[model samples]
Target chain A: MSTATIALLGQPNSGKSTLFNALTGLKQHVGNWPGKTVEKKEGSFARNGVTYDVADLPGSYSMSANSDEEVITRDFITSGKADVVCILADSSQLERSLFMLADYAGIDAPCFLVLNMEDVAKDQGKTVDVALLEKKLGIPVMMFSATDTKAYDQFYFTLERALKEKSHINVSELEKEYEKIIGYNEIKEQIKGGNISGYTPMWLTVKYLENDKVVSAKLKESLPADAASKIESIGLDANGAIATGECKFKWIDELLEGAVNKTKTGVKLGKLDRIYTHRFWGKPAVVLTVILGLLGSFIPALPIMAVASIFDVLKNVIGDALVSVGCPAFVTGLVCDVVIQSFSYIVKMLGFVFGVTLVFGMLEEVGVMARISYVFDNTMGKLGLQGKSVMPFLVSFGCTMGGAAGARVIDNWGQKVLTIALAWAVPCGAAWAIIPMLSTVFFGAGAPLIIVVLLLVMILHMWITAKIFGRTLVKTEDRCGMIMELPPYHKPKWGALFRYVFGRTKDTFFRVVKVVLIVCLIFYILSYGSGVNDTSILYKVGTAIEPVTKIFGLPWQLFIAFVASSVGKEGAVGVISALYAGGSYGEGFMAAMSGAARAANLNELLLANVSRPEALAFIFAITFNLPCVVALAATYQEIHSVKWTAKIAIYYTVGALILACLAYHVGLMIW
Target chain B: MKKLLELLKDGNSRTPEELARELETTRDDVLRQMDFLEHAGVIRKVPFMNESNGCSTCASCSGCEGGCAAECKGCVPQNAKMNMGTMWEVV
Candidate 1:
């Protein structure tokens, strides 16, 4: 019986292995190729009277000498070890899988094309004309499904025909495509009919242009020195590979134009995407989305805020019960005024936290936040930073520390520093929680207006901070454009979204409770006194600074809260809970209070004692203050420069007070 | 391909869909070109803030530095979707 060897070639996942395994069965043996770790498989079978040996080549993306598998596969084909090569491509995704065949067309081998996975292609509403493809390539072509055992007869017949006819893919169309490349003709002409074996001049020229090291080395040894230099001169341009690659893809499209039938849907942005991507409207669209998202957050928060009011009722009931039971004055005050009051405020703040998390989490899940990031990416250049710097700034809205940590993505040291510097101007998660609560308390129906104004001020603050720091921390040369692949909008996974929102709310609750309780207790103790004449240390210190604090429109008690906000924004609420309601910070202030005024809720007491202008000033001060000491530490850790870190920290501190001064005067003018 | 590179030269970020629209091509075609460009070192992916090379699991760790080593949910929300989108830049 006569024996013939057939080598199998295809890209990975092209069903090459399935066909190999089906043909070889248990007769196949696998071992590493000599000197390389790539697996080599060989097997034999008999059909009719002829013995057929199959060499299953290692699956690779292309026959480029980029890896051991590709090198070994191409080398075996050209080494004349096989009488025929069976190249496989997945019919379902021929656009991509046919790339291996496109790359292999110029190789000097007798090969037949196998459009495998015919069933999958049909299922996807695709019809591939095998005869049309064969006529175009001038090779034996077969539509195959290796998994269908009954199709073995057709496969055997095709194998027999391929071996007998010794067919090869026609290269006229492929060469025409390559000719469109700038250096292809020059290099092909230079290397025409060279002494190099197993490759045509056209193939060698293409590989040389692609900077294939192995092919270039082989040609350098085979060609005369002058011819090699001539080829090198034509290949010197670095863009040859890009041009050639584009040509190959275009050729692939041409080959499949009628051979494969399917709907060709070009990229079309959805209506919302069109608006969001527009140069003039993209920023506004993103900003509107965020503003709407913030407004939506208030809906979920209203119920939680109503629930928080129950805590206020509980505090009063518990306080009166303790007083009626003759509980000690200090114990009654601690339970009713410090701990209970702090919990009440904490619960109120948590309403906004939960609302913000759920709303923003849904936006992220639905893919709007990415567009927001993309819209802002170009603005990074105007801020004297890289496009990636926008990421940390967005993150800063959640947590300035995270934003600072996120700045590590920027490669330039100065841009990283500058990014963190501007990131600090973004009011963080805790500020988000407290700001809304404070706004609602002071402004009533006008709270949303306060939020809008605050957001506008935040934008101005970041812009100014970037300008101040950009000169020293970023270079104009460091900025560049980015290419974004926006994720498609999809329905949010409610289960996952709720899990995250509740988890974050729970985490914030625990952390806030601990800080607020401790801070409130400490402030309550320092302010506690027996009578109107009694002066605690906090009171004395607060009174001493009252005049200085008034420059920023803050009274002593509110000034102390503003100072405490630098520790943590949540801590400001704790200080307010103690100073305003616990009635120990100011001397004559609470003593002259009416019975109804003295018994009023903390909100009423705060609204009475702190004027609207002072409330506006305090809110601005806390919102723009250094996010927290932890954030400052995180900034230092990211930038690794204490000088820059201190500069940023001091800048924010002074900037916050200035903003407060401006907002206070603005509030006075409005009221 | 050269046209694609030229479009990015303005230093304004664009989505693959936008590029496809401008180039009169399909998204798949644009992506294939991007793949080639990326592999050829003509372009690179732009890593965003939360995609920083730091620990993504850490929610609150005070001791770690700013890279992935100190990843916290505080910086990156627990609900932050990883598939916000892919971004690239010319090298």
Candidate 2:
């Protein structure tokens, strides 16, 4: 419980968290960092025999104020108890770093700026004289390498000294001048009091000034009852307010003089920005990657299967050990059912994150994501989409959670809605897990074929919804604006890479394990309490559902478990395992299915039953139907509309039905 | 290990846990060096591993346990039938 408070602040992707972690080690706690899900990381560090508490605020370019980070940073500094505020800046991108620093000039805190990743700057032949910077900002500015202990130690001492002094060094008059643009006191209180609603007024003001369509809805919300007449009277569209905001940025530019300096334009800082965010390239790139993903699936699935098998072996062995230890049936299930299952799910998630994130991230980091926008950028024009709105759509491919997270990058509201709407179509991790489970258990060699069809249908359905949602429900705002940044493409550093896959997989698996253990215990109680004769009804239920399952050549028990799939993929797997002998999950439905399909020459039969192309389509239809339940709830949260959640659920359900029919009857005739 | 370090320094993908496991050591020991390497423009680090899974020799974070690091090569999809060649252009 150190009394000293230290704040680490920076713009998005500025390595602020890295510095915080370097300083704090495991002595950290995470919160919304002042009500922002934007991740507030605080840690305790003892240096010079004095322990200091450090708060790492969310990244923001400036407090001249658009995002919530500006509010958090403002609150932390204005609290008046903080000993020091460490502003970590990316040395490679000083202009951007300075942009934020320039905004912070209004805060009167003893600022010690750390120009981080100096190694990269030097490697690129960029140099900054810290003495020169220290003179420029009138603060103690240290060029640092967090990787090196000596430099890190020097930084620690700076924090130690700042804690000792506990002084508040105010900003210059130059910064006060920009306060009119970045300062937001009214919103700060509202946020702190938990009463702030929909983009703070100041945040809206800046966005409106920039003519950002994202907040056009909010702007309309802000208008008087006769807003339409006011707009008509002003002869201004949605951008009238935002246009005024961007105008002030130029005024603030004058205040930025002397405080900020550009060095050699930092070797094409804005280069490679356009080609990817290409009004045309952005969306097309998305399609191409998807096609590539489908193409890659043929080869990759085997390795994925191999990795999974390793877990199966471990689980079987562990289960036997638990049984031998005389562990109760519940305890045995707790270890094998919960722990092993959770671990397996975590492993699968890691595989997806790195496997998909790497490929997709490489494209994105290299500006390929922007290129993807090109193919579909104009698609927004048809439905009225805007900048940053494309983010959710682009993110939808990775997973819905990613799409939800990607929504953060959307600077405006129209894009947020568009991205979110499309995100519903993106099968989340749970859905991804279920399709594989169903396919492998049933289809065998045809598993990949089924998986591919489901994904395409999701995308097509998403596009239709985006188009419809834009035309009828939400007004579309399609502005061809691009954000450009040129970063030297390098290999991914494994140490720093945060694998969302692992987190998600871990989450999914835990959900599975916890619920499974609970369910087992509950069933254990029912079985013992109700007596074995009556308790056996659960098994009977697994058997009774078979006649309907026979249509798809699946076990009745699978359909029973699948009923639970709506809860989560893991829930389904857990239930399915419980139904089997020794409660084994056994082989997946896809593998079993493909073997059955091959023996009966079902592909040809399906072609004859429906149509040639419809045979493969039939398998895909069942696979794509309503993603497991976790995704449904997530979609509900992101859209924030129960009606729309149902709409998305129904859309997938219908999609699954249509495809399944097409695959079954058409395959009988065609193949 | 040196090649991996060089790869990381070159701003290539380098997982510290993988490298540490290969080096037969703890992740904590390698943590400082990885950061140092990153700071020195010797590597780039992505937050892909959770501590719980990163060192799990089982099919945990070290997903490619008991296998060649090269197995990760199959991660992305490609159109080139030349499966013999590298999928990622190893810079």
Interface root-mean-square deviation of model 2 in angstroms is 17.9
When candidate 1 is compared with the true two-chain complex, its DockQ is 0.51
Clashes in predicted model 2 = 91
TM-score of each: 0.87, 0.45
Candidate No. with top lDDT: 1
Docking quality tier of candidate 1? medium
Off by over 4 Å in 1: A1-61, A65-97, A114-126, A142-166, A180-199, A221-235, A264-266, A475-478, A530-534, A587-598, B48-71, B77-80
In order, what DockQ does each candidate have?
A: 0.51, 0.02
Winner by TM-score: 1
Q: List CA RMSD, all candidates.
A: 4.1, 17.2
